[model samples]
Target: MITVTSRSELTQSDSAPDPTAEPQDGTVLFEGRHHHSGVTFFWADTPPGSGPETHWHPYTETWAVIEGDVEISADGETLQAATGDIVTVTAGTVHRFWNTGAENLRMLCIHASPELIEHEVPQD
Candidate 1:
């Protein structure tokens, strides 16, 4: 069965990592998610000066910038992405996000596999 979800009907959740947690710099506002069919879609908002630390995932991931600007670090390089920009990270690739702008950074993230939720370890 296929279901449709509109952006307006999507619910946002206020969740932040623990202060004592290893990755404690950012907040995640998951707009919505669909777990079936191995696909998960959600939106994440990070306030200025806060974003995800260097990390990776076990599944392919794509992120589309919705607002503000973000700095993406991947494969030993960094790229600045603005609104309307899209970025993709393959499975096992190291990546991270940084809210480099004054306003909040909003992005739409889609994961290819809902079952793969573990973060990848750095290859150093």
Candidate 2:
């Protein structure tokens, strides 16, 4: 089976409540479950200086930058990514992302397992 979805369709769907507001510093535009592959697509928007703290997950992830720029850090290394760039994070690797650019950063993140949801950072 094949399913097609667009940004416009997601914006208008009542079932997919706004995941954006749930995040403190940024917005999660959309997230969908893929039954066949047991994967999920999470789309989000991050304003400058907004991003999650370092954390690790059991599932692999791939993030594609759709707009603006972001600073991606993993395993003590950091790199800047612009539009059209993609970053991959293997399972169990520590990673984080920050939007340092002036405009809002848009990204599409894909996760290999639905069980890998999200893990929050602990405040020290």
Candidate 3:
């Protein structure tokens, strides 16, 4: 079966930039309901200095950095990744990522599950 979803159809999460808010920092794009068979793919592009907040998933997620640079923080330690790099986060691992380069960061996020399930880390 084939399914197509546009970025606008995605449900906006608190971690994503609010277009209604001034000085938007970044954005998050999620796959639609059709993602529930085997695997799911979502696209994300963050301007420099912006990205998703800390969160964890019950299923594994892999990120393919298509452009610019990103800094990934997993379980505590952080590492810098650039274009052509692929970052993988195992299931239930707390993590977050940010665009640290001077340009907009583009990435393809592949999820082992068909649907998106996220548990955000609470702020102190």
Ranking by TM-score: 3, 2, 1
**In model 2, what lDDT does residue 45 have?**
77
The models' CA-based lDDT, in order, is 0.68, 0.71, 0.76
CA deviation > 4 Å runs, candidate 1: 2-37, 120-124
Task: State TM-scores per candidate.
Answer: 0.70, 0.73, 0.77
Give residue 100's error in model 1 in angstroms: 0.6
**What is candidate 1's lDDT per residue for 40-122, written digit by digit as tens?**
65567678987765777777899989998998888789999999998998988888888999998888777676443646455
Q: State residue 27's C-alpha deviation in candidate 2, in Å.
A: 3.1
User: Candidate 2 regions off by >4 Å?
Assistant: 4-21, 24-26, 29-37, 121-124
Give the winner by TM-score: 1 or 3. 3
TM-score of 2: 0.73
Better of 1 and 3 by lDDT: 3
10 residues in a row with least lDDT, candidate 1: 10-19
